[model samples]
Target: MSRNRTRFLKEFPKAISDENAAVFIGAGVSVGAGYPSWKELLREIGDELGVKSDDVYDLAALAQWSVSDTGGATRIRQVIRDQIAVDHDIPAPLNILARMPIRHLWTTNYDRLIERALLAIRRPCSVISAQGDLALKVTAGAARVYKMHGTVDQLDEIVISTDDYELFRSRRGAFLPLLQAHLSSFSMLFLGLSFTDPNLRHVLSLIRESFTDAPPAHFAIVRPPQKGDFRSAEEFEARLAQHNLWAKDLQRYGLFAIEIEDYDEVPGLLAEVERRVARNRVWISGSWPLDEATTPEVSFVHDVAERVGGVVGSSGLTLVSGSGLLVGSGSMSGFLSSLQKTGAWDLERRLIVRPFPQPIEGGEPDRAQWDLLRAELARLAGHVVFIGGLKAEAGALVDSSGVHAERAIAQAKGAYLLPIGATGGAAATIAAELIGSDLRFDGPDALRPSDEQLASLGDASVGAAELANRVLKILKSRML
Candidate 1:
């Protein structure tokens, strides 16, 4: 990955965690979902006026001309509704954005793509198209979608013509104030935008003029101009220069541009952001001897759970665990109690349990059912940690859970896995397998394990704090 991408991956998570992240969607995003751009909509309007759309680059001006020629905005409204409005399935990028924990979304689009995408993901969103909608309180944790230009569903309120642009300051009422507040407060990520709309540019300029100090940093994902779209290499280079210049000028409004090689990269970048934002959720699976509480094996489980609890609780990460007696009951239960003592444990908010709806009733769930539940938990977690177990039923459960976690992590495409061999049981077996497969090893030592260390692991003599620290280290490394 490029340096800009790395920086974005690092900073975006922090922004989401702090509830200070917002998104700005542009016409290009809608276009990807088979909708027309402003120019395309204007082109159709130009055709009605006996003017070639390609000849008119100023879409707002073209819209004004159409409204004046027809003596009203009736034709303009019809054109937008006819050309831009649709009920197509939401695009992948929009779907990812909808599922993210972002609190606010600003869009200059007239279509309902953003709202549709959010609805598809079952994410509650309060749509703001007019000033009256601003007074309504949004549900807690629901995203607020600010349709700055107006939605196609309400043609009369849509901002398209140059006259609308000129009067936008006065007509928008509380919209501009709310937008300005978000700009000053949140870290905004602008997607699929060309930064060419005059009305939006003007509003941005006004915001910049009002700020004496540096404003909060914002970002835009821009594609470098393609050579295939130009007549010659020289023409392409000139276009690239102009694009670069426009991107640099946007810095005046505190919007830094992260240039991608092409539009195809956008979805991948957005998906990565979603993954990182979800990284706060972690899952743990393992088992130890439940019969003897004073045994080193059982003691290891309690000690490690306590230390891991502190890390998860303090870091504000959610913990997901199964309901198994030794693995889930011993580890997660202890962790929850520790967090409760610190006043950081909220069962509804900070914890998630798998196997709640028992796959089988009247008896112990079958092995396949347990595996399925563990897989589901692993799929939801950004990291999975395994601790201890022997060849008995408890150890068998631990081994199966570890295998399920590994498969789920693979299916997820990316997730951190920590198997502490020092804690013994299923964890030791998994660690040995990883070493043998050359998937992971202890530093530069390769598969060479000291006999004494291996013996200590089997004997469960490793300190719980040491095992917990190692797990935390692996989890942190994956985040970076």
Candidate 2:
């Protein structure tokens, strides 16, 4: 492999490995997608208002004029939306985006390039703009795009004016939470951003204020400081470091910062990233079986549900197996202890547990064992769950019962299948690949916890409550 390709591949795994990896896009990315540059956009706005581009460069100054003008940001947004909605060619940046295993994208640009890119790929994604009636929380679980700045169509929502910027600074409480949440948990990768944008700077500042306890983790692409025009890389890094934003040396990390002389190169770069992610199988996890691995393994349970939500007959299968038993408990405890829980526990219906280990050595497999095991699965209306991993050890039992255990519950007929592993995390991404859709959740709120612990499941990382929530979501999705 070439040096650039090799470096890209190395970083590729790191990006995929993160469950909360986010792509923070900026105006630069949109430029590749045929969107206007900030200067160009200002020029157009100036023409419409009988002013010069230089006059409108400052969003606050432009907004100040808006009080006297017919419209402010709204008109600008219309022009943007119209241009993007009609454009047919795939923008270069989006093409580059096609390859990466990015679950969420945070963009400050108002254009719909990200959405358009996703649409071109035929992936379903949510567009969150400040102007829209929709709130960010509703899109919590959605996996595709999160537009932090107001979209072009909703110019009123864009924070451009000095007053508007001040308002945003004061009301940072409203939107900063989502920003902090993403930064705290996910590894953020920024693209096409400039430090000069007030909104971006403000966000960086707000994150610093709220995250005083400890510096949060995030990554961004920046120009390597040259000696003459811009400040030294050291100075730039210092400024970012002060705010806890770690500036990456793109070249050092194997990321080539080339001037896009011909916007065409953008698509190829994006395509390469997409190709890498597609070739690599990304594992998603949250269910108990994933934890069963003594070492790390790529499992796809957390994001699968939304990925395959549209597929036929995927719904309503009460999947019983070691996974289900393990998931509902947040750990192996319930299934392990229940295996020897004695007399009769109410599994209700659609449950499965591990087989009892033989007490004596060299004991022959007998009928009493069959009857005892069959009775347990029968408690859940004869819907017995089995672990996909049991093939090597439980082959004889599976053969005797005549159950095709390897097949996914979705593939099984007429059964309400609830996959007990990975919480459909990586599976959802795979399902998207198979079904050719990108419908996935972006936030933890979409991860519905069961009634047993929903109240306590607030946002704690891992505990019995969190585990219970993960299990119930897997279970109820079966009913839906």
Candidate 3:
């Protein structure tokens, strides 16, 4: 079946519905955060031992043989820890996961990145390490970080080498139950892994054998236009069909592959993910903040929004000053002039005002008006606030806005309320509050407004003076 926006969004809700969702990550996730891939790490080890990258396979085999002759697994552990001191924290991906809402994490790699991330988030969690403690406890009801493979800190616990792998294979009874429970209930979002890893292949085989009747669905992200060893999109769909995995080509919706061209890009990508997770709770009302405006009143709304751009969130409650905010230009002009004269004068922190236009007797939102409004909203920056009442008839202006706003706030994302009461005045008030709180120009340590700033925003007409006053009020409030 073809996967589209509807299907993905629908599935996404299900995937994230559980606060204790299971997450199976692979080395690729770390690689995106700038850590070396398994192949790259192996090559690095080979190079350190005076061997070429292509000679990695043979050299690894030789190393394994040497270890076998000298107590095998124990000696190999010493080789990795002493001779190869892999920088465990040099490039950490835990920072990325720390921002996500996911609690449960399972990985085959022996790295401590996930544990580090969990600790950073300050969430109580249990780390299952083969070397340190196999004492699995479910009573805490807290998230668990199961390191199916051993970690670097313990030599005897390492899961490398053919013999060690075999031992784990035979000892599957220890961890299989937990894995099965997680797999059966949670929708898995696999990262930095593919169908190629032998360990993954074996895990999939075991899963297939365990749940022969009706296996849980699986999902994996693959870079588009499948390269080298990656299964083609069509082939992946067929492979997943065997284990009930329904593959979706993320590229169709602008996120097919990790798409990391350089190491520097990883940080930015991780930051974006952090921002999205944080923003996921915010919801906007009023003018959609992104919608276009039609009249000078609507234009005023857009102007306010543009100025208050810094504060508007994607999932926060955004009440647009709707029909209730629109009034005669004479009343608006007075409010604007009052604001301009009384508010602070900081040009650096812009204040946006969205105009709410009264429809011409029988008219709806005009095309030209919407186009102008959209352009204005697009120009918003710094902080955004809404006033007046626009959708009062639907009651959505109150209900939906509150739900979304609270959700955003719970996420530690910011949202402001202007109480859809005072036409453009509320917008000005909200802007003032944010400015007062802004550390940039507060206290004896505040930014002084320049003369040009006062002159440019002096007039009060067509929403210009009101916006200027809003800016001034923010600056003045913060100074106190």
If scored against the real structure, what TM-score would every candidate get? Answer: 0.83, 0.46, 0.49
Better of 1 and 2 by lDDT: 1
Q: How many clashing pairs per prediction, in order?
A: 1, 46, 43
Candidate with more favorable, higher lDDT: 1 or 3: 1
Q: Model 2 segments beyond 4 Å from truth? A: 1-12, 47-51, 55-57, 69-85, 96-99, 131-141, 169-173, 196-198, 210-217, 223-480
Clashes of 1: 1
lDDT, candidate 3, 1-480, per-residue tens:
235323433343344432434567776666665555555555544554566645454333544554556654555565556532354553444566554556678887666677777776566677786633456464364557777776666556666555555566575447776676766666555556653343565466545544534444444444322234344867655554532331333222122233333445545544443433322221122332212235455566544443333222111212122222222222233334434554633222122245546578667756567445433332221122343223333433322242233223322322222222123333333334333343233233232223333232323352644553454354334211
Best by lDDT: 1
Model 1, runs deviating above 4 Å: 1-3, 198-200, 206-212, 231-238, 278-280, 287-299, 315-318, 322-326, 329-355, 359-380, 388-398, 401-412, 422-425, 440-459, 478-480
Go through the candidates in order and give each one's C-alpha lDDT: 0.70, 0.43, 0.44
Instruction: Report how far residue 282 has shifted in candidate 3, in Å.
Output: 6.2
User: What is the Å distance of residue 132 in model 2 from its true position?
Assistant: 7.2
lDDT of 2 by residue, 164-247 (tens): 666664543355677667666665666666555545656566555545344334445444333353358776566555323333
Which candidate order results from sorting by lDDT in descending order? 1, 3, 2
RMSD of each: 4.4, 17.4, 17.8
Candidate with the larger TM-score of 2 and 3: 3
Best first by TM-score, ranked: 1, 3, 2
